[model samples]
Target: MRISTFLNVHLVSDSTGETLNAVLRAVAPLFEGVTPLEHSYYLVRSRRQLDRVLAEIESFPGVVLFTIAAHDLRDVLVDHCKRLGIPALPLLDQVLTMWEHHLKMRAGEKTGSKQALDENYFRRIDALNYTMAHDDGQMVHEFNQAEVVLVGVSRTSKTPTSIYLANRGIRTGNFPLVPKAPIPQALLELNKPLVVGLRVSPDRLIAIRRNRLLSLNADATSEYVDEDAVREEITDANRLFERQNWPVIDVTRRSIEETSAAILNLLADRNAK
Candidate 1:
């Protein structure tokens, strides 16, 4: 039987006011094929909005998963969903239960590690903002602080990977590989951090390039996105990375999170050196 699911995550945050975005980011992989009918707002700052949201839930069809944390609000949301005859799943109910169980089973899951991770996360955010603000997407730097440097063609998931790495407490820098363009002289001398060059299959890169050009209302098919040219560029990039003894990862099937996790694992291994 084909299964269809709909999710309506109602996030509640008292201080940070970022619970919704956090939940969405966490659950992004789950909504790949599901259609998003609508998104409703019911901020805690506005009690009136909460009432309206409760009323609106009555008209909502099918299953709607809510991600609320406020006690009274959670009760109200569950009641409203039941009144509408819709299935609702609470956000942190079973998740925290399982997490607690896992934590109890693990060895040396100390508070110190958690605190260190939190501190590292904020530092990563600062670095990311700096990178974005200073980025021309072409300029190169010393990148001495980078734990791992990502090299890929345009839109080959370099920037997102860098951001993901940063979030995982790995300072990541990225450079684009343009065909026949000179790489920064400084980059050639880097012998410290592991450099991972990302490669996508030529056909996939062509499709991505085609969609990008069409979105910008530019030529849908050009030498820039030519399959042969992209293939050659990937080959050359791989050769360069090989010549420099940098590791290469074909990112054709990996998500940004997976790529970042792999990089972190590499760093962890290196630190044991």
Candidate 2:
């Protein structure tokens, strides 16, 4: 097997690692192919915690990215990484230096400041709650309350995509289009929700379902992975979407981000009209 190449990055922080995580997510995608295996050491405010984390870094040597506000802890991590022959970066160090030099102001060096308890945070929490509760058409009665509704066949990335949208403060609900099952009645009554459908090719559907079955050690006797059955399901779903006049996204070759972008475009177009 060709093992996937990945970067072993240690994210050290004095508080919650949310800012560091967001930075990594935004920057890592710029580099193609290789993924990051993150080793997060959060709330390391003392030399004692640093001692344990430094030992772990030595055992599994990798580049380290830290958001430590303490000078001694940062120095310890940097010196340890230097001795181990690896790169260590302090995120926002240069920016903080620039502000101190030019603006003549010293930062508070506080942690979790970006995640203040405010209206925006509350909106995200509410969206997350709504998304989780309405997953897989659980709360069908709340269909009219959703900002967006995603309907797709099993394993078509519905749940993950819906959760990602929720993180963006969008109230999303996803429903599965099981073979031979009727569409939900509440779905037809969605007036304000921007309902969208996801479709995939039969071959890809069969491959995904087969791998899913193998992962679960499931019986292959089920029609879930049958190519003909999947094709029929896709056809029926396409027909249903057409009758309902909802936007459709073909996710056979699209990633979750691309699919979400397309949905956003469709929503923007709908709003424009």
Candidate 3:
């Protein structure tokens, strides 16, 4: 069994660590089954925590990945990991270098291209930075500024979809629709936003809700996880979306990326009109 340990070193000033986390989370499943990997993430924002995580890395085997923000700290971590005989990968540095070289090469090879690509490139970087800061409800106002809003019952991939859209330069807000609860008055008047409602098959929903209730040590019985009630809630939500002309997405079969891409495509079509 090939076991590897993963460590994440963050910066106190790093505003985009959340975006890096999302990508790593999406790729985590790839390391399962064959090359077994056990990992722990350290959110190091202080010098004391950084020193502690570095010392801890010496006792663990395999890779040490630094989602580093500061250039000086990245050099220190890399040297330390190297001395400890662990492979260290600095993600931000590699990506930025790749992007810079790619754009520079493209500009040099293109005809009549202005130097204004720098502004666009930096803007994209800023967008990604903003995305990291806004992820996980940190920037709820940014969510409200989204061109697309995702509404779901719960665990229907609202958070994942929102993060995915953020990575692709789209601001996305998500709100869960509670059973028998009134829709937010603001949402009812959200004519400027493209709202998308998500649904899943009732059986699937029942299983998911039941598991959730059990995990929370709550009543996993009739009212909350009942199949009939779930079906009715789904139906009602679908009808509400249709009546309001909001695009509906069935998340039962689609992965988070696929569902997010579909929503983005829909928004793109609307913009084209």
Using lDDT as the measure, the top candidate is: 2
Candidate 2: segments with Cα more than 4 A from true spot: 1-8, 22-38, 54-62, 70-86, 93-108, 113-116, 216-223, 264-273
- Residues 183-237, model 2: lDDT tens digits: 7788877899999999888899899989999999999768898777778888998
Worst 10 residues of 1 by lDDT: 106-115
lDDT of each: 0.68, 0.87, 0.67
Clashing pairs in 2: none
Candidate 3 residue 235 Cα shift, in angstroms, is: 3.4
What TM-score fits each model? 0.68, 0.74, 0.56
Badly placed stretches (over 4 Å) of model 1 are: 1-38, 45-47, 61-64, 80-86, 97-121, 133-139, 164-170, 210-231, 253-258, 268-273
How large an RMSD does model 3 have? Answer: 8.3
Question: If ranked by lDDT, best first, what sequence of candidates would result?
Answer: 2, 1, 3
Query: Where does candidate 3 have its weakest 10-residue lDDT segment?
Result: 106-115
